[model samples]
Every structure is written in structure tokens, then in C-alpha cells.
Target: MTTNDEARGEHDAPSSRDPQDTDADEYRTTDQHEATSPIDRRDYLRTVGAVGVLGVMGGLAGSATGSAAAQADWETEADRRIAEHRQGSLEVEVVDETGQPVPNADVDVEMAEHDYGFGYVLSANLLLNETEPGHPYRETLKEDFNIVWFGNYHKWRFFEENQEIADQATAWAKDNGLDIRGHVCLWANVDAWAVPGDVVDAMGVDHQSGESGADLDPQHVRDRSFEHVREIIEHYADFEYEGTEYGSVIEEWEVMNEVVHVPGMIRAVNGVPGEQESDDLDPVTAPVLAEWYDHARDVAPEDVGLATNDYNTMEGSLEYARSAYERQIEFLAENGSLDYAGIQSHFGDRDSAVSPEETLDVLDRYAQHGVRLRVTEYDATGDDWSDEEKADFFHDYLKTVFSHDATDAFLVAGGSDAHHWRDDAPFFYEDWTPKPAYHVYQDLVFDEWWTEASGTTDDSGTYATDAFLGVHEVTITVGGESTTEQVSVTDASGTTDLVVTPGTSTSDCEEQGGVQVGEHCARDPDDDSLYEDVNGDGQTTHGDVNALFENLDSDDIQGNADAFDFDGNGRIGFSDVISLLRDI
Candidate 1:
């Protein structure tokens, strides 16, 4: 199972291990590790076939098939040594498809609570202004920084006017190994002033049925939605956007934006349909939404992520929308149109305080129905809160979200250090140094979450072992702001690395008491000398040589003496020797 010695993409190295590589280091710190348990390196990097750069890597591995037996023999011994090296590391255990613990399995790690799915909104729109190379704001986007929103069509008009912004955002995202969710390919309430002539032209057909002059054809909306989603996803996938210099291609797409709020906004804009000021506010229905999702899926790339969005998920009449969401999930599951669920968390109001337990319950319900939940548009705001409170609140909320078993991913709602908007509060000061709110996210969210493998490349942009095994947490930062995610190693290697993402509190893992840096983020703690209490004094100390000597014949022979004994056990230990001899 040993991986062939092949060239890895320069950007695909383990997080934080190699600071010299700009692309890989962009999302990872110079030192951090994934906290997942170690796995067989041979199996970790063994590539069969893939669809992108990895596909070429697989071909290269295939060329060395003739020497496969020799490599396997080498790997067999190496795997045993590695396993022996890592014995007891902190782990966030997740069940596999077989319902068995894949102990020491390689996993992807993130600072956030969940993976990318329903209930998460990855918002970004600041991408428009920062495209230039020399702009002072350019450096602000360290990595995975982009501004995408639900309603951009109103602002951009089309690709011609917004091309530069879109181009820069796409380029930066691809280069930095970031992913952007295509927000809302179709929104029903078209801003009258922003509506293109094509939309107006299409609306004429429905006018013949006396559906009112302002009423546009829902079918036309469907067609336009599909076309736009298809174009956007394919556009990002194309070499042009990917810097492939050919076409643009994006793997993830939010099919629509805030449909739950659409009704309220539509009513406010034009009154209820058939009423004195009614326009087409009452025209959209559940079935229409299903159609929109279906069309969006049809037009999206095979790997593209699609979702539906809403705000104030915890309470309000909008809480009723959960049923609507349920129906949406059922419809998509039945029709094979749904891939991810979008839950918008606009916490600042009374609704933002939803407990982690409650959120998990909701997510679990959805997961049971075969839906993956992603928290989209998460922001905490309140009129009476102080800067410190806001920060604390933000951290508290993230803690709840990350602790949930059902959530797969979560995304923030603004840009890199964007100004915070609320009824009344001073969240972001003039200099844009983060408010206590900003630091709340910094301590818990940013760090490296990838482990090392056979190739020279790091994990700047590809889904690694954890993700492939369904153990990844996809996090998105909003408000033009970025957050760092400290990754912990979870495998056999005792090394670590750091990975940075957006809008995440560096405290997420800290709250759990861990950090992932380079090669050994997921190493087994039992094997380290630091976790061993050489003196058997209950507390680790330098005065335990005899104690270390006393346990020479005992079974607990692992980890470092002073450094490895994370838990006090007397002995230089067998596990200690194992850890010292460990290698990636």
C-alpha cells in the first residue's frame, strides 16, 4: 500500500510543515498539525485515480507498479513502526460508514465545529475591490478570504461590470486553496432597477395570462436560474478563473439565497398578491422552490455543493420554515436534487442564542433524513451588547456549533475584517484591529489541519484523508474577515502543522484543549515521553530517575519522560522509545 514517490503539487504539502511554499502556507501557519489519529502512510497517499491534478499523480503512481511489491514490503515494516510510535493522542472520534472505530485512521481537521452543509452560509462580497496586486488591502486576504453574498445580482448587473471583482476573487480562492459557495443562482424578488432586459422580456409572456405587468414568468426565472448556476460553476472550473488560463470552475454552489425571507421581503416590497399593492410576492410556492433547486443541481458541476438559505433559524414565525426545509430536503432526496443544506445563523438578535444541544438536535434530525447540514451566514448581533460581550458571544456560539455531532460545516457571513453592522454597537474600531469579537474567533479557529504523506506537495487545496473518510469540518468566514484554524494531528506520526481559514475562533480547538500543527497533529499521546511520569510521583518532574528505572520492566513503556507523559506514568517507557523513533 506504499504510495509511489511522486511529485506533489507545490501547494499540497502538509499544513505548516513547509513555510517556504506560499500557496500551502497561506491557509496554514509555519507550525501546526492535524489532530486526527495517524494512519498507514502507504494507504494515506495511495492514489488510484482522480479528476484533477491528482489524476495525473495517480498515473505517475501507476508507472511504478512494477516495483509495487518492494514498496509494499518496505511500507509493511514502516507502518508497524509508525503505529508503535503513536499510541495515545487526543482524538475527536467519528464513526465510519461501517459503524466501527477505524482507530488510527487518517482524518481531515478544522477549527470549526461542523463540516460544510445545511444551516451554514459562506458569505463574501469584498472580492470586488481587492483584485489589484499592489492594493494595500491585498495582503489582508491571507488565504481563503473572499466576499460572496446572497444578493449580488442587484449590485453587479452581470459579468461585464463585475468581471474584475469576480476574476480576482476566483483567482485568489483557487490559488489559496479556498472554496467559495456560489450564492443564489436565482432569487425571486428581482430588484426592479437592476432587472436586465432579458428578464423583462421574459416577463412579458406571463403578462399575457393577466398575471400583472410586473409579474415575471416563474418558468423564465427557472430557466435563467439554471443558466446562471451552470455558467457560474463552470466559469470557476474553467482555467480562466482557476488560473488554469482556460476556463473558470467552482466546485461548490449555493443554488438560491434566503427563500424563507423572500416572502417577507416580497410582501414588504409589493404587498400580498391580489391585494391593493400586491405584485408577484405571492407567486412563489414550495413546488417552485423545489424546481429552482432541481434546476440549479442540473446546471452545477458534478462536485458542486448546492443549498437553500434562511435566517433566524432558532425561533420566530420563521421557525416554521424548518418544516419547509424538511420538505425541501425530502423533495431533493426524492428527486436527487439536494446535496447540502444551508442554515443561516444571524445571531445578534434574540434568535442567536440557540443552544448547542438544540442545534445538534436539529442537525441530527436532518442527518437522519440523509441531509448534510452547513451553517451559512452566522453572525451574532445585539443592540445592548458591548464589544467584549460581542466577542464572548461569538466565541460561545462557535463552541456550541463545533461541539455538535450532526453539523458537518459552518460559514461566517462577512468579509476580512469587515465592519460589523448592528442596531447599535461598536464592534469593529476605526483601525480594523478586531474587536474582542474578532479575537474571540482568532484564538479558536485558525491552524493547520492536514497530515504529511509520501509526495513533496502539501495539502493547500485538495480534500485529504479525513474528508475522504467523512471526517472533515468545512468552515467559511464572512464579513471580509479571516480566522485561523489550528489543526491537530490524529494519526500515528507525532508531528503537527497549522492551517488558517476564515472567521473561525482560534479557540474552537483551544476550548477542547488541543492544537494541530505539522506532521504529528494526530499522533498517539500514549507513545510520547512527555506523557510519561518518569518519577512515578503522580506529577511529572526531573527528580524521577529511579522511578523511571523502577518501571523498566512494566507494560506502560511509552512516550517522553518529562515531555511525553501527558498523563503521569513512571518510566522512560517502551512507548517513549517508540515515539522518539517515530517518522512520517
Candidate 2:
């Protein structure tokens, strides 16, 4: 009955749930609201997400009044004023093709610096139509990229399969010289969930919005979710190929994608002949998501970076930024189990959009709390955007991003198709030629910022490590001569100078004398039993092992001995049996 027994040769028959779907919580996006505030809920709906023109008044009512333009202008002016006081400290200009400084180059510290990289979505749901010269969408970017974010999980099924793709892409980027960034490991949306065999068979094919009155249980969802996260993170990071180094494929990953603070959302529903209602979004999903994220992080390779992503600049809406400021940080602190903060830069076409100044204000609000920020998914979307308009938008958007102090790294979204449903901006025109904006990005964002030496972890541009316990990479801008070198830091040592080897990659940086534990490996035996407590109630009581044993037969222990095997052996044996004995 217990996993220990099952591991100790007393094989228990599989239960109704599939052995693969160990954590069920991930599949069901149920709305779990602890408080009922009709007024507050309505207010959030009106001001959050994409704010309308009139919505600006309500958003900025606390600070100012009048049109959205006024609020944006005011926010911009305030940033300039504050930036002036902190001037020349964070702002670093990019060099042009002629090797001259772009004189009036205003930059954002946050967007330009923090762990910046870009990637293309490789999944079947979102891929460019294949054509001549290899995949048609590959040309959108120039050679020698620093980071490559594999867009979605659908494209990355197996380690070997995706590693081949990553190898090719990395080579292409390396031929041009590029780094690698992994988009996401665990997310509530993107339709990625580990469905058990029982749930599938019970609800036939076409599981979307069809199973009405299917009373889903939370415990089952939690179990399945745990299995999915452990499975995905371990499979990719630990899956070793013959030629490449271990964990070479994906260097960094986005831990949780666009986690929101709203409460109104639905998961599953059945619609009668002329009647249908939206399945409300989950409210209490943050903690479970956080737990899942933490689980993934525990199993992920140490060398890989995990990120929590959300929209950085709220679609030019005052309400967007305001709502984000009020609740975003709070959400993060409570459920912030990530290494990097992923901020989406999807600027929409609005004349009265929040200026770069306002964007920094929002970002700085979060940065004050000591969280590292990254511009995760950046793209522009709005009504009726022309090529010229798009190019101009790109320039302004990039300028605003580069000028901010809150940004750590920026990931510009690139793919073959923009999906007409979302916009008509041809990812590539009929001739497969890049748009003007793409060229601008190449010249302005990529060309100027990227250096031959920058790709190797040792370059001044690359962020070697966040000051976890010892030395880290710190950039010093002296007389406009910016350079990145290592610095020694500790609770006792504080921050002292450490030698940074130039022309080397971040991986090449020396592990300065400090704690060098699991820098690139999944969770070992000692830390694996820790995650069984799905609810995070803190005790390794009966409930924890029960959640783990639900999917024992699924071979879940193959990659994750730490989380699955309570006894810490490679195989789940008598120790696991003894641990789960009480759960039975």
C-alpha cells in the first residue's frame, strides 16, 4: 500500500490515476478565491489586463487626473527628474557601427542589462511554415546572438530531439556567436498539463470545455501537477547527449509564465446548445504554481537559470501599471520562488501610452524589494500598425527599454508567423524579407549591443552570477567606458574586487572561492523528499507521501530519485516503503 512497500518488492497495482500524472493540480485551473469583494473584483476587471482610454482616469486617480496622455507625460517627467539625480550611474550608451558613441543615447538600466536574450517559438502550435533556405522564420535575426529562448514546450518534446534543434540554432548563433535562454519550465497556461490515463478515458477525446459537471478533485490535480513538473524539468536538463556537455541544450529557463493576481477565471465547462459561459480563471493558483515552480527548480540543473515572467509595460494603460504595482510585488514575495523576474514588453498601439519614464517607475517599484528583473517576452501589438509605424514603434520601444534601470535582460519575440488572429504584421513579408523593424532591431538592438567577446561568459556584458554567497559580475561605467569584471562578495567580505577573464563565456568564469554546490545538477536524494508536501504545510506527514505514491507505477522515479525515492537510493526501495507506510 505504501511507496516503501511498492519499492521494497511488494508491488501494488496501479490506481485509477495514471502512473505518469503524479501531480494533478497543474491540469485543473480552478478559481480558488478566499475573499469575496464584489466592488474590488469589478474594479480589477476594469483597470487590469488591457486598460481602455477612460480606464486611465481610474488608474491614475490616486496620483493625477485627466487624460491618459497627461498621466504618461507626468510619469515620464518624474522619471527624468529622478534619473537626473541618479544620472550617469545606471545609464550606459551603446556604440554605433562607426565605433562612435550614439551621443543622445538614453538607456534603461533594467532593459539593457538584466539577463537579456531572445528566442523563437519552436512548437507545432506556433511555428513558421517550412520553406526554402531551411525554416523560413530563421532569417528574422542576424548571426551571433547571445541568447536563444526556445519559444514553447510543444516544440521541445524530448531532450535529444530538441537538443538537435538547439545545437543547430546554437551553432547558427555561435557562427554569428549567440547565447541560449530557455523560455519556460512550468506555466499555468499554454495548455501544457500532465493528464492521467483515467481522466482522459473518463472524459473521452476533445477535453476542452466539454466535461460539464465533472467535479474535479484538488488532491488529484495536485498529484498530477507534481509529476508533470518533476518530469519536464529533469527530462530536459539531465538528459545527456553524446557530444555536447551535460545540460548544454537549455542554459536558462522561464519558471512560471505570466502569473496574474486576478481571481475571475474558469477551467472546465460544458455549454448547452445556445448557452455558454467562460470558465473563470483560478484565484488561489499562485501557491500551487509556486510549489510546482519550486519543485521544478529543485530538480533543475544548477547552471540553468529559472525565471518568473509577466508583462513589464502594461499596454500603455495607466490602470495596467497601477494594478501591476499594487499587487505584482506582493504576489511575487508571497509566491516568488524564482531566480529571475520575467517582464513581458508587449507594447500596444496607443497614442497616450505610458512613456518610458512611467515604465521605469513601475519597474523600480519592484526592484526596491531586491528582486532581479528580466524583460522576458517583448513584442508590440495594437490596432492598425503599419510597417513604418512598426519600425518607429520598435525604435521608441527599444529606446524606452534600454533607458530603464529596472530591466536586467530583454527577450525580443521572433517567429515566422504573427498569427493574423493577433495581428497582420507579417513576421516576414511575402518575399521572406525581414520588416524594417527587424533591420532596426539588428542594427540598433543587436549589432550595437552584441560584441564578439560578449558571448563568452567572461565578457563584461554577461551576468556571471547573482550575489548568492560569494563573487558576482559587476559592471563599472567609468567615463563612459563600461566593463564587466568579477567582484568578491560575502556576508563577511562584502564586495571586493575579483579578476574577470575577458573573452570568455559566463560558464568559463571561475567559481570564485565560495559555496559551489549543485551548480548544474538536479536534486539529489537529500532534498527530494522535501517536495512531497504538496500543500506546503511543512510536515512530511501522511498527505505528502500519499500525493507522491499516487503515480508510483508511472516510472516517475527514473529521472527523479530525490523526489520519488524517500530512501535516497537510485531505486525506490524499502526506505521509500517505510516512509510511505503510514500514508497507506
Candidate 3:
């Protein structure tokens, strides 16, 4: 147990250094040819910004590397890079409280954050631990958290595997104080050809002349979809899994998975190509989404939140930024299915990873709707990055997640390294021993952040201390006649003190947006302001700079003059206009 000294002053929260400021900046690789050279694969990885999340549905089965735009510049660039390859590297410097290097002392540190709960996706083996009396995995699971995303317990697993596991797992979570979020009701039709292949195939309605399929009726498919919702909610809601009345164990459901990229969905259903518009709600996409939401809400009991989960929402992909976030917010706002915005955060090895500030901005964007947010399926991926780098990224990502009030939960997509979906998962190697990320998780969750401490009275007859903000149980022992007090530690300005009447028995407490439809929130779109693409040519070029100059001082600006306001002078004058050109 890592304990803080009550007499001493408070230490800095977890990481003293910025997540981006690691000392591994100058290192260059000499063994460039050592990386297995795949020309096309390497290129596609770079081209499609975040390919790591595409395989989210496949579990350990990997996903394809290509994007919707088939083979193009990504391939050409990869061809160039693969001609002379260089392996990327990652490193982490472990230091002690005194600012000296610590050489491997088997450290287990924990720092607690806010009400935003941390959880993991329970693999089948991990789920099996629910029945175990005292297994190591079970102990670890319970020790860290009681919640889990029941891995592969979807419609397919419901048919193929023993239903006992689902029952027992859910019962265990309820029996324990964990909240369960059921993954999805409808995965993309392209993703539905697995064990529950028959079920998914049966729901297929041919879009031959905007009518139902010859094999399956549209009404029948709709009925089955509704029934599927009813069954899942009812089974978990009313039935007991392991001889325990498992009432209301499931707190939320991800009504639909990734409909944002389902091919020809908008064209076939709504009479508009999915790629044609910047709009999320066209005629076709709207009804299907509405049905899923209606079915889930009608079947589920009250207070059970419904969310439409998707990937690349916060991965900073331009396509997703246009197609996914803005449109989903508009639709959810209309339907009230906006209980939680589920953004899957995953990393690809070849591309640059997302920053903490970028992710927080995404959170702020979604919080504009007043909907709770969850880091739905999270994995810090990439074989190119060292284990330490992954840990560092996870550390920073989580720090931002916990600090935000709008966030409700942050759940990892997999449990163990051996059972992860992508090869570039939490850790590189396959061993049960905890990795650096694991240790970071522990140190943050248990040691530094958790609220639990006890010490004898100081010379001042008081224990002056600080801790995380939460409802806490404090005790004062005066010669075996222990007096316990219930207190809430929530002082925003500084350390909150808990005191007694006679003397100062002080306990310290640690202190811790609107959405736009097509454009950036709060940005006036009379001009194309965000990308500095003033010319509307889809590319930022010299043309844009010329367009800015031509339209200067005139009320009728040619493009988004505001985006080119580089000098922050609040106007598109020469200084601001020329600055964007020079920077470009």
C-alpha cells in the first residue's frame, strides 16, 4: 500500500511531467530494414489516419488496412517509405520523488480520479473467473473494478456459446457493485456475417426499388430487430443468471454500432449517397436509427441510457469529423437517444497519436448537448510504439478523461495482453505479468488517487492531509472509543479541512459547449474559418491566400476570411491574411 504522509505537505497529482514532454525526442533508428517490409500495407496504414479501430468488431481477428478511398496516394507514399524503412522507437524515464532515477523496485501506484469509472472488456476466460472463488484474475478484476463490457456476449455468442456465462457474469456484476453496458443491438450488416450469421443474414432486406427483399420481408426484419432488443433487455433485466435475481444489472446499451460507414446505407435507405452529404440524418439513415432507438427505449426499463456508439469520432479523422460527430449530435438531439456519446479511442502505429488537448476539445464539443460521455472501446495500439510510450499515452488520455465532469466511464476494450483484439494492444508481449500501463493504472487508481489513510494524531493533535474528492468515511480513535464520521470532500478553491470542536483535527481534500451541425461550434460560417481554406477549393493553397487579398475590406468576402485571421487581430486585415500565407 502506497501511503501519503499526513504531516507532510501534499504532493503533485500523479505525473509531474506533461504527457507530451518525454525525453525520447532525439533518438533515431539505425535498424531501418529490420521491420518486415510490406509495401501496400505500410502505405495504407499511413493513408487511412486511424486504421486501428476498423477491426473493433473482429476481436482478435484483425481488420483490413485499406480505407473507403481504395488504393491511392497512401500507397504511393508507402512505396517511397518502404524503399528505405526506419523503425520508430518509444521510451519512458522512471524517476522517484526526489527527482532521481529508480532502478526497478516493483512499484504499484494508484491515483483515483472522479466519478468517471475505469473498467475493462472481460474476455471469456476473465468472465469465467466470475465463478472462481479466489483466482488471480478474479482477484485483480475485483480489486481494480467490478464493472465489465461482456466481451463477445452479443447476439452471435448468445446462440453459439453457453448462455450460462452471460447470466453468471451479469449476476456477478450486480452482486458486486458494477454497472454493465451491453455492447450493440445492430452491428453493421457488413459486420454481421459471423456465428450469429444466420440471424444477421435473416435481417437483410434487399433494396430492390426501395422495397423489401424477396427472401426476407422488411416488416419481418423490423419485427425481428425489435424482438432482439426485447429479448436482450428482458433476459438481463428480469432473469437471474447464477441463482441470484439479476434484476436491472444492465445500466446501458449501445443501440447501434457503426452505421456511419455502412456502404450505400443513405443511398439505398434515404435516397442520398452516404458519401454525398455532410448531413447525418438523410431519409434512409433516419428511420433505421429511429427504429433502433425506439425499440431499445420501449423494451428497456426507465433510466437505462441508450447510446449510438462509433469509432474515429475523436481519432481526429476528417471524414469522421464530417460524417460521424456532427450528424450524430443532430440526430440524437432530435430523438433524445443522446444519453451518452460513445467515442472509441484507438491508436495506429504508423500515424501520429491523438493529443490530450484534442480529445478534451472533442469532449467539450459533445458536452454541448448535455449528454454524458463514455470512452466506449479504448485501446492504446501500435507495435511501432514502445510499451512505455503506450503507457505514457494511456496516462495522459486517462488524466483528461477523469478531469472532465461530462465523462461517465472509461472502459478498456480488452483485459489481458494474450486475449486482445489488435496485435498492437495495451502491451507488446503476451504474459500475465502486469506491464507499465498496468502499473500506471494501478498507481493512479489505487495508491495516489484512492482515498484511504490512517495515522496517529500529530503534535498539534490534528492530522492535516489532502485526498481525492468523494464521499469518505473518517474515523477518530481516542483510546478504543472510536468515533467515525461521514464526510464529503469537495472544496474547489483549496484544501478542505474536516475538524472537531476541541482542537483542529484537520483532513485535507485535493482539488481537481454547444454543438454545430455541419461546421465547428461557435464559429461563424459566412467564411470557411476552420481549415483556412478560404477559396472553397477543398485544399489550402496559394489560391486561398489570393482569394483573401481580393476580398479584403469588402463586406462580400470570397471565402472564410475569419479562418485566415492568423494574427488574432479580430479582422482579416493584411497582417492576418499574409500570416496564413507565410505559415502555409
Candidate 4:
């Protein structure tokens, strides 16, 4: 039996070295010396083709073909790891409403969502304010991602002013069946950009250099920090909107961001008695940072996760940063305050991109700290590479990240170039049209990793198959009748027994021969005038045309192509919206 360590090491010898067997410096630089470059487009395609992303049901097509053979082996091993870690056996037992086993029922299982988080950063303003582009953005977010974090709105400076923005965004996310991860309760950087200007002044720290002043009071700084943490966590824990409590939708919160890179809070609390030349110049004790976690844990909900987020530990060659981050993780683990160790994977240019093997190696080193791992902020940027190259690299990177057992979530920094911090660093163009990378995301998250299995139940009325862990919709057809139930396949040993009565699972649209329009089902597909009620209003008016125009490229319209394909091209487009407008 291969363990996670052995599985991670199958690719190369350098990644196989156990950190306990080697000194700190040796382990940190084990694979750091390799000349990492952007993935070759042709090579990447060849590698993926050689072995499917998950490799759950196949072997090498051919044997012993030199470098191709080696690549194939690597991919197979990666897929093996993914299957072992990400998938679980799902057994569905079908029974009638009377609690009797139904014999020979046809069962179909389709995955509804992934247990692992695949998410991206979102702009609260874009999600709440814009109409022309906002509708598509929100639709794409709901369709493509299961989790989200605000780009800037959740920060102290931004949240202080526009608390309603975060509230509304959280409400929207809950309504759309999406999860929210709070970006940060506190950023250790004492700059006005991260903290409020008045708070910076009160801390008496230099905004530019993070140096302490004569008025610096350690207790005051700690008090202010603790207050902010309490306020942020408590407000979100029971977030109330309209008449519902949506705060529980936010499942995780970053207690501190960039702890190692921006150690101002750490220095302030420790009373480091010197003018710090650089943020990394002096190493403060890990317990000083762990205190922040302890305070957050005191105020945060028990189920909500509290994390320590930092960058450069996984991607860059900053040995000091890596060592410091590990120290913090170790201390937090010992104190039982850290729920997750967040790695911000911001890759730039081809030369700086970390290889797949190296990524596993870094993750292995940190996994020893015994904390859940997450790729909190991931983005790759290169001015010289073509869109195809970027997409290829993203595909490989996402696959590597998802295959690891220690990593639980992978969140891209941005989804569209228009809202991204860096130009050309997202999956879509400015107009929300998909780039090659966006298709890669869809193919993996929705196709390769998604589970769809069907079979006829035996006399015992049970059908079983290995499925990816997530929520799956099960449909059982027996006696010329069909019933559907949603089941969660959470673990390998779990059996989700569902009892259904036939003819009870039919949706309104199925019974009426109508189609889903937005959140409502169209009542009359044959009535041309009623079909024009795109907004679900009683009359066909200009508002319906506006609704169609706003959601031109949205998934709601595209998924209902049969009803919205007015131009007869078998797809939804501006021409269809124009036709609807003309009719109205």
C-alpha cells in the first residue's frame, strides 16, 4: 500500500525526501534548484492525452516509449493519487414509499457538486452594481464555482465603509447555493491601505516601513486587533438579511493574511526593540502570531474555520518565508488554534512557475504540520505566452492541486480579466467570454471529475459505484414511473439509502411541457406571447426584453437553449434576444 508521501514521491527522487530525514535547508531546497519553465503547449496536450486527468478506469495505452513512457507513468501516478484521495464508493439502495426493496429498478446518478472547493475571487461592486455585465458575471460565478471570497470588500478598510455590500453579496451567494469564505478579519500590515488610517495613526507605526514609534503601545494594538476580529467574525456568524440568517453560508475566515510577508502586527505585539529594516529582517517567535488565532477562535463559531494565509511559501524561492510560515503552522497546531494553513500561489512569468512535482513536494513538507491546506489565492501571469499556453499551464496546475490529499480547496484569484488585479491573468475576457483556460476549468470540474453512473438494481434494489465525493441527484425508474432524490456521498464507507414514490419527482416544467426561465418555469411553451415573458411577469413588455438583454450570455439562457434559441441556430445569442425584443 502506497502512502501519501510515497505517492507524492513517485514522480522524482527530489520530492521523495522526507523532511524528518533531512535538515531544514536540505528539505527546503530539495527541488528548488530545478529550472522550472512554462509548460509546452504540445507537451501538455500530449501528457493529458496519454493519461486522462483522473485515470479512474484505464491503463497506459502503449508500453515502453522512452520520454513518452515516463510522462505517461507520471500522469498515471498523479491520477491514482487523485482517485485514491478525491473519490469514494457510493451505494444507492432504492426502496418504495412503503419501505420495501424495489426490484430491477433503473437507477441513474449524476453529480450535483464537488465536496472539494473550486472557487475564485469576486468583486462585490461588480456582483451588486453593474447590470450590463453583472448579470453574466453572477450567472457564471454561480455555474462555475461553489465558493467565493471578496476581492477587496471584505478588507478592513473597505468593509468599514460598505458593510452593506458584503452583506448583500453574502445574501446573494446564499440564495444561489454558493458558499462564502471570508477573506480576512485582520491583515497584519499596518499600512493605511490594509487598516483604517485612524487605526494606523493610533498604532503609532510607520505606514511605509512598519517601524514602531515612541507612542507604540503593545496592549493598545492587541486590543484594536482583537476588537476587529471579534466584530468581523460575530457579524458574519449570524448575518441577517431580509428575514433570513445567511451568515452561516460563510464557512471559513482568514484570521490574518500575509503574516510572514507583512509582520507588522507580530512586531507590534512583540515589542521588537529595533527599527526593522525589512519585514523579514527579524524573525519573531511563532507564539506571538499564534495568539492572534487564539483570540479569533474565542469569538468565531465552532464550525467556522480560522486560517493563517500567506504567500511566497509555496511558489517563490523565499526560504526564510517558507521556514517562517512552517514555524507559525507548527505553533498554531500545537496550540490547537489553526484550522487551515493557506498557501497563496501567485505565479508570474514562465520561469517562476512551480512544476507539478515541486508543488507536491511543497505540499508534503507543509502537510507534516498537521493542518488542513488550501490554495487561497492562485493566479498565473505571463506577458509573453499566448492564451493557449496560459490555459495549458492552468490545466496542469489545477490538476496537480486537486490530486493532493492534504489540499482541500483551490481558489483562483480572479475569473475575468476586467476584474483581476493583473491584466490577462484570468479565465475569461473583459466581455465575460470564455478563454481557453475557462473551457479547461469546465472540462475538468464538470466533466472529468464529475460522476455519472447508471445501472439496474438487483433483487435487493441496490446499485453501487465509485463516485467523486459530493452531492449527487439519483433518479430511479420502476414500473414506468420515475422518482429522483438528492443524496450526499460524503465518504467511502457511507451508503446513502433513498426511498422514493414514483411520479413524485417530476418537475413543474416536465408536467407542463414548459422550460425553465431564470428561477421560474415557463407555463406555456406553445403560447408565443407567453414565451416572451422572459422575466416571468404576466405580460410581454419591454422589461422582458431588458431581462433577456441583461442575461444574453448567461448560463440561465444558454442552458435553456431549446426555448431561447429563437434564431434557429440551436444556441442562445444576441440575435435571439433581438428577436424577443422585436416581438415584444
Number of the predicted model whose lDDT against the real structure is largest:
4
Question: What tens digits encode model 2's per-residue C-alpha lDDT throughout 408-495?
Answer: 4566654422322133232344344455555555444333332211112222232222122212233434245444432222222232
For model 2, the superposed segments whose C-alpha errors exceed 4 Å read 1-136, 139-144, 154-178, 190-215, 241-245, 261-286, 311-313, 318-329, 334-336, 351-353, 417-427, 446-584
Report every candidate's CA lDDT.
0.38, 0.39, 0.47, 0.63
Ordered from best to worst lDDT, the candidate numbers read 4, 3, 2, 1
Candidate 1 lDDT, tens digit per residue, 1-584? 00111100001233223212211110211122112222221232243111322232223322211254643554354334323432113223322223333232233333321112212112123333323343222333332233323324222133424555556555554443344566545443332122243543344322221224545344554466456655655565543533234232344566655454444223323323211234433323445556656666665545666766655444222445566666656666677777777676555444335543455567666667676666766665555444454454454455445544445565664422332232121223333333454444433332212222211112222223321111223222334342322232333344222232232232542342322221112122344424333322122222122233234344433322344432234444333322221211
* Candidate number of the best TM-score: 4
- What TM-score, to 2 decimals, does candidate 1 have? 0.50
The better candidate by TM-score, 2 or 4, is 4
Ranking by TM-score: 4, 3, 1, 2
Model 1 misplacement above 4 A: 1-140, 143-161, 191-219, 239-243, 246-248, 263-285, 315-318, 350-352, 416-427, 447-584
lDDT of 3 by residue, 252-333 (tens): 8877665554423322334442234545555324666776787788888776788866656665343534355657766765
For model 4, the stretches where C-alpha displacement exceeds 4 angstroms are 1-70, 96-100, 132-134, 190-192, 206-215, 272-275, 278-286, 493-495, 499-584
Candidate 1 Cα lDDT to native: 0.38
Per-candidate Cα RMSD to the true structure, in Å, reads 23.7, 18.9, 25.0, 14.4
